[model samples]
Target: MKTSKIIIYDEPTVPEIQIKKLEKFLHDTFHADTEIRKNFFENREDEIFQEIATTRVFELKKPFSKHIPTKLEIQIEKENIDNSQNEEKILYDGFEFQKIISKFIPSNENDQEILNIIFTNKLTCTFDESDFRYHARALIGTNPAIISTTGIIEAPAKPKEYYLDLMVNFTKESAEKIKEKYKGEFLEYNDSRITEVVEGYLLQAVMYYETGEAFCEDRECRLYNAHWQKELLYTQSNKKLCKNHEESLRKIINHS
Candidate 1:
């Protein structure tokens, strides 16, 4: 006879807005009266095989997004192995379960502005847990997205025991994109400071357009700003070149 063991570790912080969104997703996807119960783990016991899932939402302040992003993490542990092949079978089945859950999330919206503004932008997503090991540093776009699980599976022949640890992250990016797409669209900005700020932002946008890079560090830059924005000059003593000159030097150095 063979025996298997599964262990899951979860440590997530969810915000209120994303919690509601996740609940809606669950209700819509599963058609189940899914109520996200808090403090549900207080009754859990050790060495008992169980399936556990948790959801969390977080709001990132601007330069990122006004609306918060939602995250869901799930863990499933099972025991009792009867054969040598049971370990492989469990891993395959676990991945299949992850796939099914991934399909339940939403997709990016069809709106062009929304897609261009949000879906095209990239965001960082992270996955790290002790029991399981699959983790990635970043992901692109949003709206019902699935982050792959990571971790190790150990099956010892002599001990006749199998251990599987897995972690998966799900996010809703589409709705957040839609909300940000048109935010402040109709708001009037008559203040001179606001206008100047807008102009500066436009200047940065133009720089990005001409060079295929951002003027600031908010996003990746294909070319340095010094080379791209010749009109402005600021020196970096470390590089012994002004910002404009530094970027130009970078181009020169790269070309050479």
Candidate 2:
């Protein structure tokens, strides 16, 4: 409730996002001004894309090292910025990508009370020093929070048996059959259930902005950091916050 307004930048490639519905969701939840915009990466200069391309993560286990992008890579960046749907599965260092994006935000609008949440099809990942590896993150919290639709699908692990089956029978056809066998057990590309899953992430972003806390330990909470596909669906099944978070949200709104 500390936020006076939320400006959401859409990811046009993913039509399942349905920006208008998400806008309504935020307005209804917080009684705050909600506005939707086109993808933030659109219409950016070539140099900006070059800078963003430099944030690409190559060695997943190693820490970030600034990448010197190839001409082809830069061209791909431009195409992606133009809202082309032919995006390759490129990995980007999420925090470094966020810093690049922050530079493009209008200086006047860069204030604490206006939450800028960006939605993207790109996979946003962070290198964990403790684990010494990269991990996909659905929501990177803060003023300009990023919700990666790809991350939502890819970050959470699928059922163990599915992986075990694929590990043994590893042809493309077999893999496709394995995925088909576990179809409804996890989120897939172009899944309609993304709308509900995304709502949870948006809630997490707002909660983080308001309280400086982005997650709940309870699997029943929408703010719970889900590591598995089953957990993600279970947490989002009812689309309700846990009792304590609900109370905190009420207090914030009331005080506002």
Candidate 3:
């Protein structure tokens, strides 16, 4: 492993993430020292909040253009609030958000040996060149990787049948009923399965830093890049690396 230690920045709003349990999972799985820290956005500078506010994506179909944030938006950024608690969704450019987080790291602790993973309730998204549109991403893989708890629920596509059912005579109340009907099929806010799903993302971050590969093609693999909610649940809940990833993991650990 290129990283000697792993540090996780917690998202306190979502207690279902179970940060301490996640720390234990890392130690038991990788045999590495893991540390947990408080929320990353807390106590940040006014300028930092201004910078973060500019990363929000208002137009999904278009590529990223730096947003000129309103005073209210900047103020919203400054406020220490659980963003997920609100019904409205806010989107941030994942790479831009990662860059902001990278700058926030203390220089003394910023090094190859230290792997920093930030857990955020904000939805992080990336613009796809092929589709020419922004798409929510659960993990933004890098030195300071971001695991967006909101993205975990929103990124993956829900069941096709559910959407089909929703499209027919859809009303706000009807949509609520549809969501209730298929509640357990996909991750909801405050889902207990978040901790398990996050473990997969954490491993992907570590493996990306160590081996330069962040994802696998196999759905059975914990590192699989899942586009659908069912696949995400299946891959993460299994909690086992595929043969190739298992071998790669062993090699990385042994050689470290």
Candidate 4:
């Protein structure tokens, strides 16, 4: 493997992401030394929080521009609030947030062979020029990878029928009923299955760092880039990679 070490920062607000299980999973998968840290933003200076708050995405239809954050916004970051659990969601520009985070990483640990992966409950989004809109992304690929727990639940499209039901009902109660009807079909906040679902994303980050490819086209593979909730559930259910990726994994380890 190209990566010799991986440093994972935890999101304590989301207890479903058990840090030790993730640590063990990476060790078993790659035999790479792993270390866990508390939330990356924890104990950061007030300016760091204010700077990060400036990266918030207010207009999903437009490209990123620096936001003059409200006092509440900076306070939210300082408190390490998990807004993903609330109905009113907050979005941040993924790339911009990554840039701010990169500035905080120590100079000594800035090696290509050491992967730094951060887990957060914040929703991270990227602007797509093709669509001219910002879209939520579950994982952002790079040296210091970001895994958004909120994005994992919200990014993928839900069942079509669920939306159709809401369209016809058009009431809060009806929406809740519809959600309950399709509950198991998709992930929700604080879902127990998140622990299992996150493993697939971890595999994606690791494989991307090693091979320069972040996803598989095959739906049966764990590394498949799933755009829909059902696709995510199905691909992760397989609990394995495609034959080609399996071979690639062998080569990655062998060459190392």
The digit string of per-residue lDDT tens for model 1 on 7-91 reads: 1111122111133444453334223343333321223442212221111113222121122212222223222221111222222
lDDT of 4 at 73: 82
lDDT of 4 by residue, 1-256 (tens): 7788999999888888888999999988888889999988777788889988999998989999999998998888877654545245789999999888888888887788889999877789999999899999999888789999989999999999988898888798888889999989999988888878899999999899888986999988999999999999988877989999999988987876
* Candidate 1's TM-score: 0.17
TM-score of each: 0.17, 0.96, 0.96, 0.95
> Number of clashing pairs, model 1?
17
TM-score of 4: 0.95
Task: Specify the poorest-scoring 10-residue window by lDDT in model 3.
Answer: 79-88
* Alpha-carbon deviation at 243 in model 2, angstroms: 1.5
True-structure RMSD for candidate 4:
1.4
Enumerate clash totals for all models, in the order shown.
Answer: 17, 0, 0, 0
- Model 4 scores what on Cα lDDT? 0.88
Note the Cα lDDT for every prediction shown.
Answer: 0.24, 0.88, 0.88, 0.88
- Summed over model 2, clashes come to 0
Over 4 Å off in model 4, which ranges?
82-87
- For model 4, the run of ten residues with the poorest summed lDDT: 80-89
Give the Å shift of residue 254 in candidate 4.
Answer: 1.5
